[model samples]
Target: MLFNEEIQRVFKSDSWKKVNKKLIGKMLSEYMYEKMIQPNILSEEGENIEYSLQVSESKHYHYIAQKRLFDSFDVKWTTIYIVENDGRKEADSAIELLVDLQDVIGMSSETAGHLIKEMNSTLIADAHLLEKEAKRSDELIHEDYASLEGYMTGHPWITYNKGRIGFGYDDYLAFAPEQQKEIQLSWIAVHKDLASFQSVEGLDYEALIASELSEEERIRFDVKVKQHGSEPSQYYYMPVHEWQWKNTLVQNFPEELAIGRIIPLGKGEDRYLPQQSIRTFVNITNKDKHHVKLPMSILNTLVYRGLPSERTVIAPKVTEFIKGMAEKDHFLKEECRVILPGENASMNVNHPYYTQLKEAPYQYLEMLGTIWRESIYTYLEEGEQAITLAALLYEDHHHKPYVESLIDQSGLSTEEWMEQFFKVVMEPLLHYLYQYGTVFSPHGQNTIVVLKDAKPHRLAIKDFVDDVNISDQDFPELQGLSSEFKAVLRTEAPEGLTQFIFTGLFICHLRYLSNLLKNNGLMEEETFWSLLADAILNYQSRFPQLEERFKLFDFFKPELTKLCLNRNRMVDYGYSDDDDRPHASEFGKVTNALAAFQLNRTVGSN
Candidate 1:
């Protein structure tokens, strides 16, 4: 197959053109909002907004965007143009947009070139996925949870959403979530020396493995292990990403393979569909089986898609602590039915070299691990379904938002549907914040929206160890939580923890949802923000005793710390192939849309 032919086709196709423009528009708008570039604002009258940025004296990037609430941009895809000083106009491609803004964002030549490559893979992946026509609103409305999950698009806020930098074309086809392929992971036997498996009380190593494999497969696996002269008692079995085994581990540690310390035990029987997060897989064979999250050493988006060895050990412990807290709280258990899908078990293999090197970056220490998380499907009731919160904002081929699809089916007015929607999502989140000073980054992908009859139900939160955080203040509630939980969970100040909810739930997820609502004329942008305020305030009025906790972490603070994702990429090292996840850069501020609306509501009452 000619590589260039395929590449050119994806780049030039009508769908690719639309997808690329949307991506470019998003990158330009977000980077500008993050203060990476100062665009000359030409005009703003209601939604009719125009801006131009000087990439250089000779070149300019121009766009007409409908300004959404919180100053987000919904750039008109067809209306973007790159104007040359020589009086030539060119339609913007994904790569061209990155190159144009690279200098403006103060990125080095090296970073610019690398970012272009990232865009190349991203566009290529988009090309492969975008060819499929979008389903009708009715189709998406009736879509099964798993199928609907596949329909949901990439990160609502990120520009280089599909940049799986470490993947080759073949790897992209086999492992990337967009491919919708069933991946059967290869198992590896790690001698007792290098491997450590941690688990919550009930979920042991044997049970977790048995749940994923049939009895015949388990017998076959044990037979293969015995033929290799290894006993189950002596070595721990860990599931390895098949691609990671061939591409990384086998080559990196030939000594371990030769010494029979790390022996491959062939593939497991279960077929898994890669969830939206790329590394996390949902068991398609048995939906109730735990979601297997393995470390794939690909550098994607902001970090290498690898799990930290240190955190892996404590993941189950942390999950247990959070689970106990959720079940024990009346608001969480009785009212909202919040489900914290426990990270039941995890296995981490210590790096042979990185552990010895004091200053090595974190990803090197994170290259190999697995976290077996309890599946939310295990807890779903009859007629209940769960979809990624990202799907709520998803626009199908016919440009229909999933929420609107649901509203139509529920036979409820838009306001009632949306009110119910916000209550279910925000109630548990606010309960955890005020009742227990706990915070989880319920970003679009991490948060799951459970529903029945296309109406909002409750939330099922996952990705515990990495995504969840706790308050620095020692609440009485956290008294008996294990020392491992205390150590593993990041203790941030009340305000800092507030950012997890403010930035994660509000900016990362709700901002785009708000745009979808406003764009479709389902609701005004201001009303959407007001509804969010109403969600939190209504939750607040129920537990008056937690008012101090609410005051401690004021959501109504005038400004929020802007998480500059694109700017974070542009400056500094531009990212390492293997390093700790970079710190979020606070570039600038936008008016707290929630605070603004809440203040307006209070003033209106008086």
Candidate 2:
């Protein structure tokens, strides 16, 4: 798989020009609405009629629409045509008819809106999946090729093409018939399933090598060899379960040298089973590095063994290490940080947990590490510290600071700061929470609010944890964790989860939005109550379970409004610094002021 830069380059190449054209045409027609004006002449005394004037302006309403279309499509056109005709009423009618025609042709406003949303969603999902697949494919290909190369160097006489193995004339002539016979007999004796071979008569080894042996002679030879086989031969018959030995033999041998003595790769105390391999190559040149020795096939297996498992999530430590490296080197932040924990660890084949969870920690970590190193790390900067932090905080991706050093440095008035804060940070976050069921938001620790030119313009959510509990049936893996950890982590099983969500909402989102509103002189109690109502209404549509769990609408309606009003009162009564509760009259006065602000804003606007 190619790198992200290469993929993007391909996307922008001349071959994609056709796709761009259609995309641009669709974008323009969708956003560039024609405002057709129909001017009708009205007589003061109803005495005379005059010709009407019609004007049309084909103006693009949203800069975002234009920018997105241009960036995605790279269209060639710069200008669009606009027509003006006589008679205002006629022009209005014509414009309406044109809009209807566009709708009939599937270019309607509603259709375009849906398409745009879907396109954005598809792009994000595809990019993520492609990166994942590319990493996996690359690791498999690299390991397989390395193994294959080592095998070829060890057994030069064994020709391998397109993953198939064949013996050449040199291999056939390398050993004498007597030696081959002894080797075959040794193999049969070592494996005793071929006891029926005791009935076989004579074996013609020399005639078999020369292809001059009779069919009966070959059959008898195969039967006898199966009784005591040692030598490796493509023609040797074996049970289906025993075929794996062929792969084991080729893989265990080192390239470019004759097999001497076999040695176990690991010590007895190690948890993994020991495998024997023949070391052949004593000296081999590496083209990539003049001073480095080419690795023997036998040694190559060691490298493969160190790879992470493919079933469990990557260990937090491994993820952090990779992330740190990437950050120091200037890797793409978004692409480098997601480390799946399940694919890096290993599992014991015989363990009950393995059967229950279908994974092991070590195996999962290895797989995760391999993927991160090959794919995400490639996109990251060579040595980034944040990548390390990201790995360490993989489980809690949303826990980050809401303010940065830059914000402190920027010397803006509190009111101006709040306006920018709400626009740039709070608005987008509220939208996300409302849409995606995201509980984590811009809190003091979970966000970094970067300020530029005395304004909070950039917001980054640090340690954002997107993982959530749905139901046990939906994600059985949650059952694998200890019950204590499960209690802390589970957001779907108990009543306590509701308090957690409320803390995330009220203490995090509401608090931040409230602070910004207070700073901006917009913290009226009525305004706060209205905002809460809007949030609840929006939330209810997405999470219907809330209606059943808390009867939230009925139980919290009065309190929610009261909380907003009281908070606003605190700001209005010149008692903002006070931590203690105030009198009822003071609270009432503040609420009255809040109500007046809402009343004035509504009536004055109309």
- Which candidate ranks first by TM-score, i.e. highest? 1
Per residue, candidate 1 scores C-alpha lDDT tens digits across 1-606 of 646765665556676787787778777768767777778888887767788878888888778877666657777767788778667575658777777776677789988887888877777776776765557767777766656666656776767777788788878877777667788988888887988989999777888777777888777777777877778677888888887888779877788888788878899878888887788888888888888998887877788788988789999888877888877777789988898889989999987877898678876787788999888888899989888888888776767777888899889988898889889998888888888888889888888888898888888988987887888888987677667676777889877899898888888888888878887989887777888899888887888989899889898988877776776777864865434578677766766878787788789889
Stretches of candidate 2 above 4 Å error? Answer: 1-411, 464-502, 505-557, 560-606
Question: Per-residue CA lDDT of candidate 2, range 1-606, in tens?
Answer: 425653564344343433233233333332221111122332222322221222224221111111111011111122222233321111112123234334333354653343333333223222222232122211212221112112111110001101111212232122111011111111111112211111001322233223322356445545554444333242322111111123333342322012222211111110111001111011112111110011111111112112222111222222333234334432223421323211111111112232245333322222111111111112223322111111111111121222222133446543444445544444334322332222332333233343334354444443222223322322332244445433433344332233233333343234334433333344533455344444344444544644543242131322221112112221222222232222211111111122343344457669
Question: Candidates' lDDT values, in order?
Answer: 0.80, 0.26
Worst 10 residues of 2 by lDDT: 155-164
Model 1 clash pairs?
134-397
Q: How many clashes show up per model?
A: 1, 71
* Candidate closest to the true structure, highest lDDT: 1
Candidate 2, 589: how far from true, in Å?
23
Backbone clashes, candidate 2: 71
> Residue 279 error for model 2, in Å?
44
> TM-score per candidate, in order?
0.96, 0.23
